[model samples]
Target: MTAAPNTTKPSGQDSPSTDTAVLRALRRIRVPQTQRNRELFLLIFAFLVNGSAIALVQLGTMGAIDAAFLFYCGALIVLVLAMHIVLRLFARDADPFVLPIATILTGLGIAMIYRIDIAVELGGWDAYSTKQLAWAAIAIVGAIAIVILLRNYRVLFRYTYIFGLAGIVLLILPIIPGLGTDANADVWVSLGFFSFQPGELAKISLAIFFAGYLVRTRESLTAVGTRFLGMTWPRARELGPLLVIWLISLGIIVLQRDLGTGLLIFGMFVAMLYVATGKTSWVIIGVVLAAAGAFLASRVLPYVGGRFSNWLDAFNPEVIDRAGGSYQLVQGIFGLAQGGLVGTGLGQGRPYITPLSQSDYILASLGEELGLIGVFAILCLYMVFTSRGIRIGLAGQDDFGKLLATGLSFTIALQVFIMVGGVTRIIPLTGLTTPFLAAGGSSLVANWLIVALLLRISDAVRSRPRVVIG
Candidate 1:
């Protein structure tokens, strides 16, 4: 015979004489593995596309596959996979599309750069493609570290003023003697053995500063504006920040001779301001200020005037024959025309015909080889990327995170527009390089940092604690 055991019911909740306690289950916005697994699948596709691009380039140009380029592709994939692994381990809730999109775009860049190298008969470690791969490795590693280390993106708000000051210093680094390079644009900073455009990093720092600053001051900026032109305009006191940023931008155009970056920084600030305040007047003010600045810059800066001339009259023989001519722009246009609706098929078309084709004009290179369809596809990818970033910002719970993500997203969108618009003659060509599709180490590293920060913010957004509801 077995003895029956008596058990007492738990007492805190559902007891007749005691106060009932509320019970809640811990909940997550998503299963962490779901996001990570989606990311992995897309990464595999990106790898295949990148590898296929290299294969096509080699076969089209060299009549056979090059083992060296294959090795380069392998190296690049390893770096990309390394970032994926870091995200899986540290940021499982991160957005799935961002890493894969960045991987494919940058991988395509390498493949195109290699095509140009082969066309130009350049090889070995000195090849620009090889150097670009090296930069990609550095950039990917930097991104991985950022993802792993930056568990919380909000800590950045504590140092808002510091970032703002640092952005100014970075913007001015090129003007400092012994550090500045005498390029057409004084945006490069050299350290004997290494040189990079400080403006690239400046954009990131400024975005952070702007996000934090706006979060702290949005109320004052939005509350006390005058009604005018069917829009509420900020008071004179509020205009101080706008005026300061505008002056800084003009200084970039005039002192640093970097009209593209100047416009980029100002545009980033303005976009962020609009996001924070939700006011149309800020955008109107920003455009008027930008337009006024551009008009003034065109008159005072020879470089600005030259870019306008080259842009408007690229086909003119006189403009083509000038010291700083539209010859490059015209060639880029011809290359795109030759590409037509469908590209000339990778290496078959002569992307190397345009100077700096792998850098400032890489879009033209890709457009020529891949055709109008290919460029449209690339533009669509940009749309997807920016949309993802904006979505991430909108999903955040905190103002700083939202503004920072939006600012960073807008920075990428604006840079692409500036660079691609210039390349297409939709706007005057500025010194801005195409985001991931161009060969600039500074741009690569800085852009990857933005990606990492976005991933961090997105993961945080998803992982914020919630009460499970039946």
Candidate 2:
């Protein structure tokens, strides 16, 4: 007080008070500790519980609780460590809840597969459950690597067409001799040690392409065009590309007997169109187009006609006689019946008896074991996830981000609806997999990649500075 000399420090000198304020601000902005950690721990717990339940069921089947217990414990430890290490890399920006949700779905799928394996083993047949477990491990590692490596979403926009071409190529690859196997006309490629389905990748790559393309053309598409029926119709010239794509996709369905994948791709296109135009009229047009296409296909394509016929008479005993068509639907319906309300418990239901139990009919198996409640829970999870995606789309800073989010979100929404509708008999059966829950390498990998992109866009939204307008 006598002099208080030099109390005002040099401008370059750090003020302890200022430093404390900055640090406090940073702490406030840091990731929420409770939310993030809680989600992670819950997923880890889910993984353990799922594995243990699988082992218990397997042991109950084989009367070898000790061995199954040991194996289950080991597998759980491996999966958790693998997932943790993977998430540590690229998923840092992902929603705190995304990984946890994925974890539960993935873990549950594995458990169901393991349960099937035990049942098959008891019948003296080779069990693929162990193989499925191996694939799950691979998928987790792949997801982590993709998230870490693909740190930028903008790159996708740049290479959307290229990726789309690659996806189309992959889809057509199964037609190659010695490379593709025909399964009811839908080509399945054998990758020597493992077989891969290209349809999954096609869905994602095409979505990227659609997002980039639609974002660029949306304004034009919605702008001046021949006004008809109180709507701004896109010029025939402007609509040509979409028609070509629709035809190509339709051709694929008719030619390859891959109705489910074709329907999914078409649905993606229609949804993108609706988003771009924001026109209810376009939806009506789309439905009309879809109906027309379906009718034409049924009139021309044998498989399509047969499927439509089978769908029309689902309850007829004669319809269920067809191995390539209605049998799965009939069985799936019966399985759901078996799982009326609360389910038969995780390992108790007869899910494995259904053909294609791990693919399109996985939902049926899920319903059989987990019951209607479980199905509802899963649908709710998808709904929540979709809602978050929509929020991200709306909050995105650019057209590309918004379209990307919307397209990706709608892809999932439509796929879930189609598959769930198929399983519940609300609609004719479409052989589409449940996104994260289905057991397929390509589907699993592609879906996780989608999650990664969504997370990146979401982070961009979250990290954006608040804008104050005068």
Candidate 3:
């Protein structure tokens, strides 16, 4: 009645303007500046500590900064600066935890790589420290750019099929005529002066595809189908898709002759399926199928069969001396055993004795030089990393976020387990890189991208506004 007595309010009473609203919204958006600063500080500290330590060791050995040492130090400084700039430019909003972890691990990796390089130079194999520094610089730039540009991981779901197909093609491309190069353990693409492993990229893409696919299909995959002995099996149609993936994975193992990457990819799928569907039976089924495939592979594929045999007879008189198979493993065990409790000191041990010491056998090198204490530190870092990753997965608000985090975390866990287990004789040899610690361009870049994805997911999870619904 009577326009509610002009309850709208008198003159001079007004709400905030559009401009004010914009400023207020910006304030509410938490720019992640403080976290970024903390990461920057940590990166600087780690770089200084690691770089200075290297200099001190070199100085002690060669007695002061020689021309080669100066050149190396100058190059390293420039590269580190470049990488730092790249991180600031692209990953400004990334989760604080990722960059610091990356920095610490990268520092450790560089130190180890350089340590191996010095030994290799003395042995006439032409050490790769320079090239490794270059690769690390490029990887850091790429990681930052990816985190900045690809803010929404969900966009990957749109191109899941394309990514999956391309990934499969890449995994098998190593078997293609004139394209693949069998670098000791197999799985590499030789491009003249620069060789790269496509499986590194393929693994990440496939994990994305698997996560997106499994999350979408878990409902049907877990639904009760036909009952057998009081147990419900997935529908035939549902099983068909999984079987196809399994076959593809096995094909990678056989054709590419890379059991490590094959097992990694398969483990990713199985883990994601279990996480998405919450079905233990699916895991059991996947394991059984994997064992059956392994049996068949052992009998058929000579290379695979040899690997299993080598793993079995690792200490046998006949297998211990062969350079191609058991030599590295035997040397690795010897090195670790020599380290015992106190290690041989940083630059004192002969880690380069093992083939591919900077890459696949880096763990062995670490064990020899760092000893049990240093190796334990490395293990603790991984444990911290996994614990943080799992926290991110649990904190994520959406299904895709959860799956992505879980898949990434599980992938790292599996890689570490396979590598450490192989070196420690807990499992058969699998030539997988120790993430962040291994020396390979493709691996470094791929792993950095993984860290970026986790950072992005963590940012989303952390920034999400809570709401109450009745």
Candidate 4:
């Protein structure tokens, strides 16, 4: 009847419609592929920058390049390329910036470690730089394994309680008699030739557990809070979980004598808790509790008391002369001052003058050589990395992913602030490594795993189709 009436739709119009649909599909497919190409370019740039740093260190320290150093660099490049291939296969839509940023930071750290090793005359496998490179290789492999195995980030939510229990066990491992080894802090566990910091692993597991737990209980937490002083506060009954976490943190501080890890774990929980509940009063309560804990810790814990004293009276001759005094803090400040605006040109600066220059004081070491501009550049890398993580969190499709990403990003931001502040004399020193730029196997492994998880989440977020309802 329609043909008879000559009322059929035009074929010309239908051709245009089909072309438009095909174009839209092609665009959708090309976006992720283009993003992957950009990632590859950035990764190549990162590799070149890292390689140059290694070469510079060789030339500056020994006046020539070493074949062994080149071999190490080649191995690193191969491993990193392998990681990039893994990402291409499994995490095609993931953020392009994360891996490159991590690579740059890790490379800078290795270069600095090697410089320090040269200054100290350490050689072969005994060199800290060699060990750092080895750890880098291991960490990269671990990250590759994670991206391949943990294809779905949401699966972690299924075993929330199990993750929590595992975190507790990890935290307690260092306290066990034969397993635990005392280092600068009592957070290390030794197994034959291998020593690791279980607290590092514990923090990650705890992040997953906290994300899952908060997602489940967020409604209850946000529902019945009281308003006070322009803020909503949870009731005393509601504060039970927080109190338990605080006590656990305090136990870590007192028993393990690790104020940094304790503070990190507790602060991460508080940040995530505030984010989940959208309550400022939780922050206030956290601050008040933190202050009270600090006060008591200063009065009762000798180490805490000493740190406070150092922060307050760093320039005092008596404090400076005391054992475990403000000498390291003061030295770090001098190094920063010496660095001025343009740094001492990498190998020319005396970063080795600072205590634990390769680990806790790496930021100060970098400041001494890179100068203020260089230091700020390094900080910018961290800032970008953290901001990218936050962006991923904000873009997530699920509440659990949002909390997890935010918490992980906050954890890194807080750690950097604390470490930098301590080195700059803005706060009392605590023993936390500077993420990718520090020389520790546990920290390296944990941070790489973080990178892998974030990649997984970003891939999932980007690949999901957006719905536009009329």
Task: Find the candidate with the highest TM-score and give its number.
Answer: 4
For model 1, residues 87-191, the per-residue Cα lDDT tens digits are 878887899999999999999999999999988889888788998989998998999899988898999999999999999899888999889987888889999
Clashing residue pairs for model 1: 343-371
Model 1 misplaced stretches (Cα beyond 4 Å): 1-30, 466-470
- Superposed model 2: Cα runs more than 4 Å off: 1-24, 32-35, 59-91, 122-126, 226-230, 323-325, 464-470
Candidates' lDDT values, in order? 0.90, 0.73, 0.76, 0.90
Model 3 C-alpha lDDT per residue in residues 1-470, reported as the tens digit of each score: 55555567567665668557556566555455565677678767766766665675465345564456446555655654554565456544455666666666766776777777776664222456666667776776776677668877778878877878888887877787898775655588888888888888898888788877877777888887777766666777877776887898788777777888878888888888888887676787789988888888889988888788778888887887765568788889999988888788777788888888888888888888789997898888788777778788888778778888888888888999999998988878876899988888888888878887887777677763422223
Which lDDT value does model 1 have at 234? Answer: 87
Name the candidate, 1 or 2, with the larger TM-score value: 1
Tens-digit lDDT track for model 4 on 347-401?
8888898889999999998888889998899999999999999899999989999
lDDT of 3 at 19: 54
Which ten residues in a row are the worst by lDDT in model 2?
461-470
The local lDDT score (0 to 100) that residue 243 gets in candidate 2 is 78
Q: Per-prediction TM-score, please?
A: 0.93, 0.86, 0.85, 0.96
The TM-score obtained by model 4 is 0.96
Top-down TM-score ranking: 4, 1, 2, 3
Cα error, candidate 3, residue 72 (Å): 5.4
Tell me the lDDT of candidate 1. 0.90
